[model samples]
Target: MNTQLVESVIQLIRSLSPEEQAILQEKLFFDFAYPSTPDLITLALRGGSFEFLNDEPDLYSLTDGEPIPCP
Candidate 1:
């Protein structure tokens, strides 16, 4: 991801409450498969999980079905 976009997402995530943050973390770790779209982003924010959203066609798949590696 681009630095700016990643920064923006980090800012948005920071704005969420701890419980919501936990939900997002759990999804990121276990449920979400990324390369998500704007709609999927919205769904994740609304549902607290990415399970309802479909895989994004353009974004790259998460290799080895693993959680995103930490920087």
Candidate 2:
């Protein structure tokens, strides 16, 4: 293990401006922050998790209900 090299790298990171540090941090941890998981809605659809919706009837329409009477 190169302890001196690690310490030098830490010092270099510390010298970066806040914005630069933020960019560096994101670059370092981007994989962990935004993993390659399927989108939630897509996963649900493709996995048949919402297959029950196929059995549900269309119970309401825009014109199905009576309009309210204005006083």
Candidate 3:
């Protein structure tokens, strides 16, 4: 990913509270097993390797590749 984009993502994550950060990290790792959750937006912004489907407004779905599944 572009360095600028990565920086932007890091900045956005930093803006959230600690609890919100934890929730975002968890959702990024377990999107399929768990139902969609509040942190989906933040996860998408980070741009995992998987291809994402833009189902909801300003939201996306993992269409291809496995989600990174990390915290």
Candidate 4:
């Protein structure tokens, strides 16, 4: 670990107000709990399951509010 970088980050975090710290803590927790979409897709592809989504009938794109048009 880079001790200097760690110390700098710690100092920056400590400079935040209590409310800001709480918000940052919640965001970090959420990030740890849920992987990003691209990360999830990568994991699914590695598991040989990503293609199944294409076969599903009721799937929709998360980026756009539009439904996925079936072929």
Every model: Cα RMSD to truth: 18.0, 6.0, 18.1, 10.4
Can you list the residue pairs that collide in candidate 3? none
Candidate 4 lDDT (Cα, whole model)?
0.87
Report lDDT per candidate. Answer: 0.79, 0.87, 0.76, 0.87
Model 1 lDDT per residue over 1-71, tens place = 59999999999999999999999998888666565588677886788576545564545555646686889
Output the worst ten-in-a-row residue range by lDDT, candidate 2. 31-40
lDDT of 4 by residue, 1-71 (tens): 79999999999999999999999999988778978899988898798867777777975456758676999
TM-score-based ranking: 2, 4, 1, 3
TM-score of each: 0.40, 0.50, 0.40, 0.44
Q: How many Å off is the CA of 33 in candidate 3?
A: 6.6
For model 2, the superposed segments whose C-alpha errors exceed 4 Å read 1-6, 27-38, 62-71
Candidate 1 lDDT trough over 10 residues, lowest sum: 51-60
Query: How does candidate 3 score on lDDT?
Result: 0.76
Per-residue lDDT of 58 in model 2: 97
Clash totals in order: 0, 0, 0, 0
Residue pair clashes in candidate 4? none
TM-score of 2: 0.50
How would you encode candidate 2's per-residue C-alpha lDDT over 1-71 as one tens digit per residue?
99999999999999999999999998888956763566666778788978999999999889888987999
